[model samples]
Target: MKRIKWVLGLSLVGVLAVSGTAYALGSGASGMMGQTPQFIRTQNQVGISKMGYGYGMMGNYASSNGAAGYGGNGGGCGGVNNGESYSMMGGPYNAASLGINLTDGQVTTDDQALSLAKAYVQVLNQDLSIDEIHEFNDSYEVELNESKTSNKAFEFLIYKNGGYISSEMGPNAMWNTQYGHMNGRNSGNPGKPTVTAEQASKTAQDYVNQQMGTGYSIEQPEVAPGYYEFMILKDGKDFAELDINGYAGQVWFENWHGPMIKTINNGSTTK
Candidate 1:
């Protein structure tokens, strides 16, 4: 059975003014140093139906077989990109199929994905609510918050065809020092790391420059548990997002969000 991270000292919500987005700082020994915190809540509470991705409320799909649950369908929380099973570390897993049955009218729309995400989080026993959802080519990235507080909690990926959901890899998994899958949902203070935020930023720049070549710029870093995240920009727009390990200095580029088509904020508040 997979465990859930029960966040502590994050109940007190404070307003962080950043480009008009609301972010709150989590207090306690687990808190990271600085104002830019992990708990974020964007005030873009728009309805999904009005967003017009064309994926309206699909249907109430009750999977008695339990294949729609988290890590179900024998994929083990891995993702499918370009029709291939990918490991969390960013590599091909195998040639096996993702075991998704794309039945007619069973496609996972934003609304359906939110339902699946809510159910999955409920099983984990965390008091989280869906904050925003990003619809990519192959999956849906659902960001959760701390109920009424609206403080950012964490994110997970739900496949568009099958109901396979898992914690987002990279920073959300590997560098999350306090809670979540990498920490086994265990509570502990991962003291400050040797690598500074500036160093990690440079590390990201150097890595991207070497791999993706020049003309790529790194945005301001968002401090998470044990990693710093940056939006890699090309022509002053989001080209890709990457994370740097605070301790080991490893870089992981996000390859999951394939050409985001639509987005919905405050999805849980709907229906």
Candidate 2:
């Protein structure tokens, strides 16, 4: 069994022109504050089913990087867990080990578990598109716990796709495993581990202000900084600009897990 580590980083840079007309990027209007887009795909109608175990531990945290101790096993472009091996579905034990504790009809096999997990990934790919789905693969990992007695745990990366995107590991995974437990002892004050909505909003605003400069209304700007990229939105329509970070090099924001707008640098687009 190998321990997998998930690390998220914001290092991608993308530039898009702001076209006033609203164009659905399949993200719907959810990215916008209000005003749902004309195109709507309901979950029920889409027939998208949940994938993997719904347990908070697995769903919330999964490793993405290549590490030893606990990590995911790749197969058919998907992943699964082996004995004492961690995976996205969550399990420190293999099917046979789990079967020991369950009643006659309660337990399932590893193959069955893997099948269910793959099914969920299929539905997610359909809804989010293959590109988005692949993007996520870079962030999550499912593995087993080394301790025979402990259930499977997860390690979540802060970025959306994988640890490759955001440099910070997610708050959820960090608190439970490392920060919460010290030398196998329960720390008295394991602070709550959740990102507040206000905090998300402020992060977005700060990123924009720091790179784009303050006081430049989203609508009109005195001088569009050639260095920093921008995702300008107006009346629910949005477009992005490249070189928001001065365009000396490219930066990938694929790890910006939240819904906030992003800007990446892709070399000099200015004089």
Candidate 3:
């Protein structure tokens, strides 16, 4: 397996506008916070059945259809360890019990979400900074970086309604077998896998074809510790992103990001 190194001084700029929303993109943004437990879908050969609150990256469970699936990394950089949430329903949700007011027509701004994220990071006692911000249909995915080295740390989702945050489900949490939160912070040493990037790409493409229809192409693999993250493109544009387990070849799609509205590269370093 190749070790992926992030260059510190990459000249990432601009707030890309998408779907009529223009976000001010920068690296010097504030923070993130929340706890929305995911109700992950474990797929079978035909479709999906059964939904479970996936907490922690360990343990194995069989879907209602009898397909094996891995749970998500639960406690990471100030995340809940015991599957805590207001709703038993999976996916992102609002936390009214946490005093998050849901006034109609209210949307969370980038600055506000970043502020919440920073506060959450501080609460975890982790020295991390905001690296990137991705706007989706329902939430904003905040990519974090190590404060000292300025290297990519982790990513989390902040729901728009209440700024509720949680560990990103796919590669950042589960498929990242080595640094994944499942084995605890920066624990686990899964080493390399026999499946090459090219092979992983094929597996991802096959999974996509099975789940989705045609006209979709898989991009090059983003090598992680225990899995490979790939971008699904349609007509040469990013459509969705998913990860494949390097050891078991299981597919985990990032279904949280409903639709990407814009991407912000906040290249700021935190002290």
Candidate 4:
């Protein structure tokens, strides 16, 4: 087995903020920073649901039977956010690897909701209570915290439609639609992308080569409220993901797939 040291849900959780590092690519002195045209559309669903390897709970998924990234929005942790896998290094992973395309049932379950809470606490090996469970459109949001002292800081989501109960665990990350608020109030506006898809793709390619020792093919970037989501593929299959700021070409989020490897967060927070 390979040494797959990871933080887990680093998907949705670890990559939230933008890097303030300014690239001097304006004139020939700094180089050419191209314009970012329309957003790059992709076929694969890359939601940081699992906001994070929140994918995390981290499930006991196998690298060989690797699942695609999945996640729901709202707030929470991944290794990408919270903790490590419960059984992954052992066996038996979750079946819920659904990304933002979680359109299955409109059902609800007290047991299902509670299970998510339990899973989270189990992973952290901490004591927690079901703080709250509310219905949000097609998904059920679950909240949890330490059993007694009232620490409502950690939160996650559970999705269900019809009778299909799912947590979509894996190294899935999600872009929290709730990014623009603080203490129950709006914080500020998100920055718009200054670079075009072509420009961002070139930056992403350069990043891939720097990280993986070789360049890989990438699709156009998805324009969210603030960041650009790039779905990287190899041999026409989902291999990795990259999130960069359109305004500054900052790579915000990233995750790779392998024969049972977990996600990694290389201290690339804030930017």
Candidate 4, residues 1-271, lDDT tens digits: the string is 1122223332432323211111112121123355321122111214211111111222121211233332222443322112322221121212132112222433344554445445544654556665555443334444443477654333344434422222322112222222222212112544444666666677767655544443355777655434455656555544545655444444433332222111111211111
Model 1 residue runs over 4 Å out of place are: 1-75, 78-108, 145-152, 183-187, 256-263, 267-271
lDDT of 3 at 151: 55
- How many Å off is the CA of 133 in candidate 4? 23
Query: C-alpha displacement of 98 in model 1, angstroms?
Result: 20
Q: Candidate 1 residues 1-271, lDDT tens each?
A: 1111222221011100111111222231133333233222222211111111110011122222332311101122443433333323333322123333445524455556666666666555667777767676656777666786665556676666455555665356535765445443224776776567876676667656654566677888866667677767766655556776565454555543533456666563221
- TM-scores, in order shown? 0.51, 0.22, 0.55, 0.35
What is the number of residue pairs that collide in model 2? 46
Which digits, one per residue and each the tens of the lDDT, describe model 2 over residues 1-271? 1111223332221100111011111221123333221221111111112221101111122212221111211111111211123223333333243232323422133333333323333432322111111112222222222234343232212122211111122211222333211112224533332333332233334334433343322323211111122334423333222111111111112122322232111211111
Task: Name the 10 consecutive residues with the lowest summed lDDT in model 2.
Answer: 14-23
Q: How close is candidate 4 to the true structure, as a TM-score?
A: 0.35
lDDT of 3 by residue, 180-216 (tens): 5544433566566655666557656665665555667
